[model samples]
Target: MLSYELFFKEGLYNAEFIKKFTIDFDLLESQVEPYTPEYASMITGLSADDIVTTAREYATSSGSMIAYTLGITEHHCGVNNVFDIANLALLTGNIGKQGTGIMPLRGQNNVQGAGDMGCLPNQLAGGMSLANDEFRARYEKEWGVKLNPYPDDTQTRTFDRLEMGELKALYVIGENPLLADVHMNHTKTLFEKLDLLIVQDIFLTETAQMADVVLPARSWGEVDGTYTNTDRRIQRVRKAVEPHPNTKEDWEILCDLATLMGYPMHYHNSKEIWNEVRKLAWEIYGGITYDRLEEEYSIHYPCPDENHPGTFILHERFHKQNPDIKKSRFVPVDYTEPLELPDPEYPFMLTTGRRYESYNTHSQTRFYAAGIKVKQTEETIDIHPEDACSLGIQDGEMVQVTSRRGELLVKVKITEQVVPGLVFMSFHWSETPTNVLTLNEYDPISGTAEYKACAVAITKVS
Candidate 1:
């Protein structure tokens, strides 16, 4: 994570390298590994002794940088998933190696940039903590705007207020919240009550269809910009096509909107925007330019100059005392049961995710030379083999999935990809619309909805 400004607290981050509690081998009755058996057997229904033995075996295994994406996160206990991985990294002390580190993959190409720019609820632009007066002062000095000292930059509340009809207007850009977000009905209900809804997109999306104003926008191909990938790669995107005459690139689009909103937004080109982002938040992202990026296809950000070789592995000296002092936090976890466990009425816990073929949602890929058809939509309720046999259902058979939020008819894909107690489906579904079945409950800290866990019942249909 390239941050132009923010820094981490030290002692908060440490491996069990330093002794804390007295270790009693006699008292060490239980052994646990992360994700696997040593997994929290108490809460996760895993075998404690078995996982401990297996974790011993797992520790001996070696490989390249272990990178995990949404497969690890997007869970009821997503934070634990990260905590465990970080612990595993600290155990082996996999810092400052060429092909080592706990690589928690990101959801988007520009997620790092967004993180740097402080799109999060808690931080300010340039990675400054919203609570820190010093960080706020730095931004105030740079922008010359009397920014609010209070720490209240909550997008979760903005969406929540929109749902409650407390917020009259909502502007969304390059994102399809309808299919992309969990609890589809709740979002629709809230958006329905809104006096005005604005959606800016390269293509007409399901969310755009419901918007009061759908502003056409240029795609990455028709735009010149820089996208920082999960690996902190700073790459350039050139304009391969014209900005569709009517639609403009994101930078121009933002500037025009800001100008109309009485903010003096000005930028001649994409390079200028990058320069501004660098200027505002120089600690993490310093003296870097398109000309420097053009020298190579991509290089990691924080390179700071044309002369610097990129840093792929971070935190060798940084994580230690009196150095960079940026040790990754090791948060020991206590597992909690998912909100909705399997019951008689709702006999299965439903979880949602993305498929390799589809991107965010179906709208982009649904229409082909043939047409958009329900059968073309590849969403299926992933049922365990035992569950399918017990429910008297076969693979490819249609099933009625009912959840607390709503219900939908979806095909059943009987497989052992997931555990027996849980069922899986992709949020990418539009016709089946998996989000319709998801609950509105979200992570209190991240405001990330618990899209992964909801009570669902599957009955053989059609």
Candidate 2:
């Protein structure tokens, strides 16, 4: 089989690579040899014996599922990491079948839906690229509006633009950038300079407190809408109670704002908006109506018509439908060390992630009784017992963790969960905001910050 290593060796990314090769899966597989378990063990930290056992088990199994969270996508090489996952699945023939798939566990409830509806800066609804002439034309005809023919700057670039005075206004919805953004000090400076900062959310978040306008929107229980889950299941949410006296539903507020801005958005209710969404992206959402949702509870996307059942596993007849494009291609990537490394001055590696009790930024979770009881009110840094002892820090003692950008005071939890040279923290509390110490460098393709790794130095304060 043509292994990815052979594909790279054949000058696939060079000027003459495409002209010299064809996209034939069988031909390419035959030209290259698959890597042995020992080779994989060299790159990953896993032992060769464990790797061999895992390889055997996976190959022998009828179906297997691979699931990962931000751990796989919160690095400088995040995009390539996802590509590596896809390569593994394709090589093992473990996709597009029941009981087998590569699933990304989203951080939030509707994150998958947001991507499908084209919340990305580079694409329109349903991930239709503005750069694609055919896709752009079709969307323009369907929406009766002309979209920018070029991709817009990503959220990272947008912040840079705000700092540079290139952009003035920022309308934030359901996000608390002050507490959540990498390099919290820098993010604060950028937000302060914006001529108009509008925040729409259920609570007065740290970011919302700084905004010129804070529009109070109804919470989940007071709104009626459809939510798409990580598995692409479209499920309906009904109103359990009326909205607060001062608060309006998110859609109603948005529509009223649009009307005032001369767009003339006159939707009577949430279902009217749903009908419009169905009309705009019929292939994925046509059969998913509120009535159908009441009957079936939920339906996965690619539900083309009312009579059609929702797709469970995707790509059943993919190769048959598109002989050339349906099959997978092997793209080779090289591993690079993280941008920041442990130096003599900052001789510790820092990683940040979410905890079971606290969600991102704690905009709402901190208010929950269960979330509060699961952990202490303040955030604590998890450090190895060896590191804590070496640094003269005891468990429950306060420590000052400093990075190149900024620093924060967090409590020390001496545990063996982390390695000797590494420490971990979650950005759940304002008292010990971990983002202040995180580096601002992000993945070039996905524009996601490198939150998984950075260099830091810690000093015991107590």
Candidate 3:
């Protein structure tokens, strides 16, 4: 493992802070052996020489950055994986500076924005802790209402609540959980049990098909809003076309629904809603206004006031002086095996991801003629040539992939991108329904399903 010290603006950190954090770091790292290049090679299947060379370069570099995507989060130990990444940054003193620190590529556009707008079940806008008394008081003052100290269940737990008849209704938007969530059959059963299932989207997705009420919402081109990209750049999304005659913006729909339910929501337009967000989430998005978005094209959050230029690099001092902040603490984590391991029966590891031709679940991209032409019209499993030969499977031939949960017959694309004992498939086509074969085991903390690794057996389709 790499060893380094904490830095502040080219100078060493305060002696007291460094000593305390060093003890904490040492205690955490003591739980496991140092990850030497040989150990990494054994675990990751990379060459030892390459691993050593890469480690040397990474450690000796003036500034280094690490970025990852769903591949890191879509695991049974997703939260721990993130902690380990953070630990690496801390060890190397690569944080709180430009061209350094960690970056997690969002799975979709506006995913960061959604969280910033308080879409999570546990936290309020700007990542204010719902459980914190001070955070609640601040939001209550801004919202003019008492806030719920205890947050509700996460999306993963909704199915459990529905199964127990505790959750009677669900309001889904922009996501097709039926085709996207792990254990597709189980998700479908839970949807069937819901007393009321409401879906709002631009298209009738598989989940919408089962909804008791489907509300058509305006598409991106028809709505004016802001989308925060993976790097925290909040960009304006102006209406480029009129919404469909029968549809309206999602905000308008929600406002109407809230008013009808006797909880009146008064917002003249999207801008009004954004202004309220700015008032409440002043810590992160205070400086990002609709007017600024139009003028600058985009602005990063933690923008404190109107005159303050939007911050590009975050954690200038690593949240040292901000209100309601605490000194950073070292979180040590150890590696764990995947929840589901390949066995003699299921001898191959199956991993799912996106293709360039399609976005998540093909909500919109499938209909694009050019995208369809660029990729295979249907779902195909990517297999190494050696694995296909052993299974008597030919290139472009049909193969049956079976897990304990379900099975699918898909065309095979023999390639070297995947190792011999592993297969990769894009979960983009409804026809293939890849989620059916994915394990339902999820990270205990993040509740993100283990879509990156699962055990499945493959055979040539007769």
Return the TM-score for each candidate structure: 0.84, 0.89, 0.92
TM value for model 3: 0.92
- Cα error, residue 85 of model 3, in Å, equals 0.4
Residue 224 lDDT, candidate 1, scale 0-100: 83
1 against 2, candidate with superior lDDT: 2
Whole-model lDDT, model 1: 0.69
The CA lDDT of each predicted structure is 0.69, 0.79, 0.80
Candidate 3 per-residue lDDT, tens place, 159-275, comes to 777888898899998899999999898888899988899999999999999999999998889998788888889898889987779998988998899889987887888788787
Poorly placed runs, candidate 3 (over 4 Å): 1-23, 142-144, 318-326, 370-372
Candidate maximizing lDDT: 3
Task: Give lDDT tens digits, candidate 2, residues 1-462.
Answer: 112443334432222222222234444354334544455555555676776656555544787778989988999899988876765566556667788779999999999877777788887776557798877877788667788898898898898789889999999988998999899999999988889999999999999999999999988899888888998898988899977899988878888998899777677888887776677667778788899999999999888788889987786653234434433575545556789999999999999998886778888877886534565577889999888889988899988999999988888998898978889999889878899999999999888999989999999885
Q: Indicate the residue-level lDDT of 124 in model 1.
A: 82
Segments of candidate 2 deviating more than 4 angstroms: 1-44, 132-143, 318-325, 370-372
